[model samples]
Target: MYAAVEETVQARLILSPHRSVRLRTVLSYLPEDPFAVSMAFPAEFSLDEAEDERSAEDIVWVFARQLLSSGLELPAGLGDVHVRPTVGRRTMVELRAPEGTALLRFDTTDLRRFLWRSRLLVPEGEEHLHLDADRALAQLLG
Candidate 1:
């Protein structure tokens, strides 16, 4: 059900060294927080589409790590901070930020909800999706 969605924005790929390496187009929406990331990768990475969804958990982890390593834009006040959900095992994500050389941590269930609400989960075999309204990515330019 978690299909990757694509759109264009001002996000510059920093970790990427080449111009032609665009396998995944990640979209992160954090208008209020400026740090929460809802990274969407190819459908092959989502366990939801697998016949044995539980077996595909490791693939999800690999994808998450690979995607995070590609580097997305981070706002100020997030020095040494990172937020990511761990594969199929995580119900909550670790929200970490640095303050005076020390890392502050908070476990939250919000990221999962954000990611779900950001994308529309169409049932399988649906060929057309008439999207008449905008999604979470609309907040990027606003």
Candidate 2:
């Protein structure tokens, strides 16, 4: 059995070329959800701005772990989220929704370090071994 892995990396909220805000972004992986990775940000950084009364909470975005891995070298993802390497050894993450979008920049080294740590627990090509097919099928049919 694999344990959960979590890391917090500093990110820049690119509001504009001339302005940006520093944010603490949390990256998490759980053995139960082997195929996916999650990024959690402050609730205010949500892609949907329509919610005017948000309590103190986190907005978590879950996506394929492969998406984030491939994105480090080339662009990945096509739907509500996108990740790609940027100049200066940084990575750009775009969160898109009908209401709004949030652009974030993260250090490539930080991301790589976190991925490496996660691989130590689950390893590459071993994620499938951690999945419970029966539980997933039951959840789908329930």
Candidate 3:
């Protein structure tokens, strides 16, 4: 059987030091996709205010699970997505796209709790056992 973990967390879109927007973010992980985690934002939310339209569907960013874990303790990631710890029990996640960059601030406790719950489903170092390499290879080959 496969299991998935989803946690809803409150976050702040850091528009500026004084200006910010509150956002409801969903963090999710599935044992089937063992090595990755996903962050989904509301459809109404626009990463780029200057864009012509707000996406009708939720925006989800998928990245390595280990990157998030490492980020909890120190800065991690290189391009498109980056995660790092911040002052006052907060974590900063930077998402970069052609439209613009979105700087999100989340509570460290919330992220930690989410990660812990995901680990219960697919523990660290055991992801390889759950992965379907043949299926992945087939998808890539296609």
Candidate 4:
């Protein structure tokens, strides 16, 4: 049987007046996978030319990168970060974190994936509360 593991990370979300958002996150790894990781702002959060609406795929990417970056050790087994933008019903990005590699899947047909993962699937939401980008980045560095 496949065992499911839940991990947590803390991050700050910066939203500009233009609606551009940046996420600074730190991922903490578990004993099973030992390496802490950090990401300043992954490309998924880049909304350069996007109109007013924020794409679910972008949001998912930010969350995924944030969570993965928190782990104990970035998995060496995973070659490199794999990002798949708007494809079929879901968008996915795969990358190694400190603990282990993570595959973030965002369902375009249902926003439930975002809400559920944020609330239930991941560790306690308290560990990943919202914060400022600069502060979050500082924590990652220190």
> Global lDDT of each model?
0.31, 0.88, 0.91, 0.37
User: All candidates' TM-scores?
Assistant: 0.21, 0.91, 0.92, 0.22
Q: Locate the minimum summed-lDDT window of 10 residues in model 3.
A: 47-56
lDDT per residue for candidate 4 within 24-63, as digits (tens), equals 4322222222221222334454444443444433222223
Q: Write the per-residue lDDT of candidate 1 for residues 1-142, one digit (tens) a residue.
A: 2344333222222222344122343445432222233443344433244346545322211123222322222222233434333333232122232212211111223333334433333322231342323553576556
Q: Which ten residues in a row have the lowest lDDT in candidate 1?
A: 99-108
- The reply for model 2, stretches above 4 Å from the true place, is 50-56
Summing lDDT over every window of 10 consecutive residues in candidate 2, give the lowest-scoring window.
47-56
RMSD of each: 16.5, 1.7, 1.9, 16.7
Candidate with the greatest lDDT versus the true structure: 3
Query: Which regions of candidate 4 fall more than 4 Å away from where they truly are?
Result: 1-82, 111-142
Candidate 3 lDDT by residue in tens digits, 40-97: 9986667566545544667899999999999989999999999999999999999999
Rank by lDDT (best first): 3, 2, 4, 1
How much is the lDDT of residue 56 in candidate 2?
52
Error of 2 at 7 (Å): 0.6
Clashes of 2: 0
